[model samples]
Target: MAMKMSLKLNSLQSIWYCVFVVVTHAYLIISAFYHYHRVRQMDWPDGTLPKPELGLYMLCVTAALLITVLFIPTQIFQVGNNANDRTKLGVEKGDQGPPKWKGGLKAKLVFVRRYTKHLGPVGATMHIVSAFCLLLPVMFLQAREIEHGLLPPQSIWRSEVSLVPVIEMDRAPSPPPLIDTDLMSTNQPDLKPHVKEPPYKVSMVTINYINYVTALVVYAILYGDVFWFCHKGFALLLSVQLMFNAIQYSLGFIGVSLLYKLHTYGWDKYGIPEPAVVSSAAGLVGLFLTNNITIFLSAVVMFLYGYTRMKESELRKRKNNVEDGKCSVVYKGNALRCQGYIPHMGALCVLVIFIICKSPLIVEYLRAFRHQGDPRLLACMLYDIFYIFFWAFLWVVFALKREWNFNFAYLDEVQSVKEESSQSAGSTGSLVNDNGMKNNIELSFVNRYNQDIHQRHNTDKVTEVKMSPKLHVANNMPVITQASEKYSPKRLRNGSATAEECQLLHQKQEHEPIQNGVLNTSMNGRPV
Candidate 1:
């Protein structure tokens, strides 16, 4: 029997998804142009992977674009266009689509399978090459940065890793994806039933163990703060610090994984291995630059973040019962505040620097290989390349995405406010409070409406800023004054209070809500 498939998304959700696809596509288009232009500009022999590995990187990126595009069904909401709506598949009204079914993990798995079928071997090989190309420099020039004691370059050292022999001190195969021989998979249903699992699985499958080891390693290698502990008596400061580090590392790992998966599983017809590496080189560059660049980015983000809260605090100054459209302080005078996405731009700028400067670790690794006289050997000797542009592009994409999200969030709020205002405008007399003064005339009727909203969002933003008791805020720290406790604590801007305000607002240490005086940390998705 011939089967028909249909997919549908909720109205708003459909728009968001479409926006995501469009933005992603736009990034790809820009990157592609950059790659093509740079390629032509360089006038290198056609099709050779760019040194520092840009060619393969671009190819891999192109493949990723294809993979992402495939999953986005153009017919976002298909109900047979009304005529086909009355299909024989038994789909009901308002059912969201054919068979009126939800595409949960099962659908995702199907998409993944289809994706793999199209991109399996080619993309996989490209990824292998990408990893291979990236490690050479680490093995060569960058080896000094890592500590791998008394072993063969740290690749062959058998600990959690098994394959690539560490040429240095037990350093888990120089670059990584070290195999845990015990856990290697024997299944390769996509390739062959009996074929041993790809070496990548050694890294992918055992990553959890790697994380566990990382934690233990931190415990062994890192020292808890002593001076602060001596003075402030912070009981779990070390634990908190460890948790934050873990979270940061995990996020970085996730970003790399996303890039990796996009290159490997999420590629299109993965062909000649060399070009694929060139494509991913860009992503690698972005990841590398983040170490330095993100410090700047994060700093700016934190500041703008705080500033946004300041704007909110300013807006929320005095005036109880902020009616739909009324003059007060911040929004009272001006409906919207354009702080701009300074942090996102900073992140992009730094990532651009990474892209501009990225080079394959090959030069360094090649030196080591040459010095060690194993020029022909790379235990998993599948050479990959790295580049600056493609890598930086990943960060650029993220930065743009951040902007897009911010834009959408603001738009959503605006639309909702307009709806509410239009409704309220009809019911109540001119929202201009009795001074016969059009208090809200300064704002576009819509802006005023949007700024003033329902829902007790105020309380959600009234979160306490936590600092280890060991860290002290001097009396000179910034201060925030509270007006009244009557209003629900909506997040004013980024919802951060000044240092002094946060200190004053700190939950009393004596009134511990949770065990260990965890205070009212809402990060765990629960109130203490």
Candidate 2:
């Protein structure tokens, strides 16, 4: 019954996975058509579209199609492998009994799950590669915009020109003495001339629209993983990307607002058109603001979810350590892992908000690139390139440094156990006998045997003795002792003892018998 339920759940998940893939491909197809139409409508003043523009749009469509194609095998293989793992584990646990019925839909599902595991990392690699490839065209287009000044300058107010009505009045006849008909007709004031100012053109609106769309597609590609996988590193990178999009849109909105304000104050004087102001304001609120708010909210959500996952993993690790008996004195320091500092989720969220609000400065800086010389543009381009590389470097560093599943505390536990075992083994080597004295009987016999041989070899020489208040011996050998009072010994001629030394020695001498040519006992009746 459990096996059946497990299979049912797997089938349901696989069905949803299939639906997601289908919808993704469908969206890609729609996007391709949209871009194709956009390319077709794009016209050049010379009646011939630029080759680069046409090619870029076509490449976008091609890239979308390529992503869809690349996703299919990965989806299929990933689902199949997941199902296979579930099946194997379930069967091993005795949840899966003998097959009840064969050659049915269940059988087919089982077969598909088990047989498709060989494709392996190919699918996962393709999935990641496709995701990475999606960003290349966007980066290229942004670089081109920076190079060619395709994006509009932000200083729209500087272009305003005042419109003054020019009135030409025929010279009035002096005092109108005689009403000459032609002269009186000419004196009538010409109808006040109407002066109109051309509407302001904002160049950034279209580029902002394009960027919003591109960012949306990229977000969609990462959406499933961010929610389902909840990988912290991936979440962090996603947050960064969303933060960038939000900031870019917000700045675009600011530019639109500036244009609106200029039009409101100087409309009549500068002849600003109503349509330009209305469109700019509408796009700012409806398009740019909407996208920015959405991306910002999504970034916050991802960060919160990732932080929650981290906390849960930490708790689970501690629980496992308690179960394994590895949580001891050696593991006291295990609470702080991965660089010894816990990330403050609240602080991180605030920082993200700060970035979203203040990143517009970057946009303002880049806006100056067009009005300024190529040097400024080059600098901006370098900054943009370095910005992404910096993020990539951070991602790599986090990935390499992060300790995901393994517990470092367990390593300390193992080391402690080894140290204890070695200590126990060493203590066991020294045995104590029942007599309560250290059992050195065998060592004593060996020392005695060596001393007897040494005494036989040195029988001809008299043992040197020093007069002292206390005397002691070690390992059956005489040891010289320091005297309480300093005394100088006189040198004897012919290497013989002096009369004073001989008399002092005789006062302390004791007679001893020899047995088997070995010296008899000294102080404790042990052989000397």
Per-residue alpha-carbon lDDT of model 1 for 116-146, expressed as tens digits?
3211122112222222222222222111111
Candidate 1 wrongly placed segments (more than 4 Å): 1-160, 164-209, 212-341, 352-362, 369-387, 395-528
All candidates: TM-score: 0.25, 0.29
Q: Please give the distance, in angstroms, between residue 324's alpha carbon in candidate 2 and its true position after superposition.
A: 12
Q: Give the TM-score of candidate 2.
A: 0.29
* Native-to-model Cα distance after best TM-score fit, residue 308 in candidate 1, in Å: 8.6
Q: Clashing residue pairs, candidate 2?
A: none
> How close to the true structure is residue 157 of candidate 1, measured as C-alpha lDDT?
22
Cα lDDT of candidate 1 equals: 0.32
Give Cα distance to truth, residue 290, candidate 2, Å.
Answer: 17
lDDT by residue for model 2 over 1-528, one digit each (tens)? Answer: 123432223334433544564465466456656755664554424544445644765665567567657655444433444222222211121111223346877776665554343122233333333432332233333323322334333233321121233444444434533657575465544455444553443333333233334434444334323322324345446546554544443334444333333333333433423323233323323543443454444444444334333444444543442222211111122233343233333334434543553344345334433433323333434444454455445444543554443222332343343334333221001011222222221111113344322221122222224322212122232212222222332111111122333234323333534422323344343544
lDDT of each candidate versus the true structure:
0.32, 0.36
